[model samples]
Target: MTRRNRSGSIGFIVDDLNPMLRGWFNYFKHAYRTEYREIDGFIRRRLRAILLRHNKRKGLGITLDAHCQWTNAYFAELGLFTMHEARVLACRPR
Candidate 1:
């Protein structure tokens, strides 16, 4: 996807990072066994932050959890193997 398109949608960003999800997940699991939930939450929040940045162009504002978009099954629905995938991905270097 083009840089413009990637910046416009969170889907693009996740899809773009798909190849690295496994490695990212493993790395996080191995490195931080205890902080998984917090790490996961950060990833969700980061995605919301990205959406917020994009929405600012239209002068519309939304909380990251607007309409309950962030949820327990979010990672699995996105093709992540485990709930901890969020934590792993969140801890990965940018």
Candidate 2:
């Protein structure tokens, strides 16, 4: 997803990758009995990662602002924060 960028809407990228992602999920589900929710969450993280990668090399504040709604979970996934820290962040008002 390094090929994607923040220069335009994400709809086009999703549209382009939908078939490949579906195929991957199908293979995992059949070969490993993966849970739908797990695969779904994984895909969400992947998409988020792509966005973060694209948003990198910019101001830290801008990067964070680009995904404020994704903060705690995202940072936790990156090991930038512990789960407890993320939970506390989730509990705080914006």
Candidate 3:
């Protein structure tokens, strides 16, 4: 994945490619689109790597910011996480 600077351009590679995470990659592709392809790609790779690494290490209790409450609620509606659970998860220690 390529980290982007303030101007919104590719900064660098985050990791090597992995075919198993196509779905996650596609989600980022849709989120960032062409204007920020590099950044999106980098995030996809990085997130995939982090998830995989965490799984291998059996790490859990992850948390995230509740900045976008509506978004989190939507995700919960879609069965991603409960609102209360997401809030707690958002503050999980790294």
- Global lDDT scores for all candidate models: 0.55, 0.48, 0.34
TM-score of 1: 0.53
For model 3, the superposed segments whose C-alpha errors exceed 4 Å read: 1-35, 57-94
> Candidate 1, residues 1-94: lDDT per residue as tens digits?
1232247456667666555655656666557667656655665555555655666533344454542765546644665334365565766899
Q: Write the per-residue lDDT of candidate 3 for residues 1-94, one digit (tens) a residue.
A: 3222212211112112233234444454444333343543344444433443434533342233222322333323433312233334545797
Order by TM-score, highest first: 1, 2, 3
lDDT (C-alpha) at residue 21 in model 2: 55
Residue-pair clashes per candidate: 0, 0, 7
Candidate 1 or 2, higher lDDT?
Answer: 1
- Clashing residue pairs found in predicted model 3: 1-14, 1-42, 2-42, 63-89, 63-90, 64-89, 64-90
TM-scores of all predicted structures: 0.53, 0.40, 0.25
Winner of 2 and 3 under lDDT: 2
- Tell me, by lDDT, which candidate is best: 1
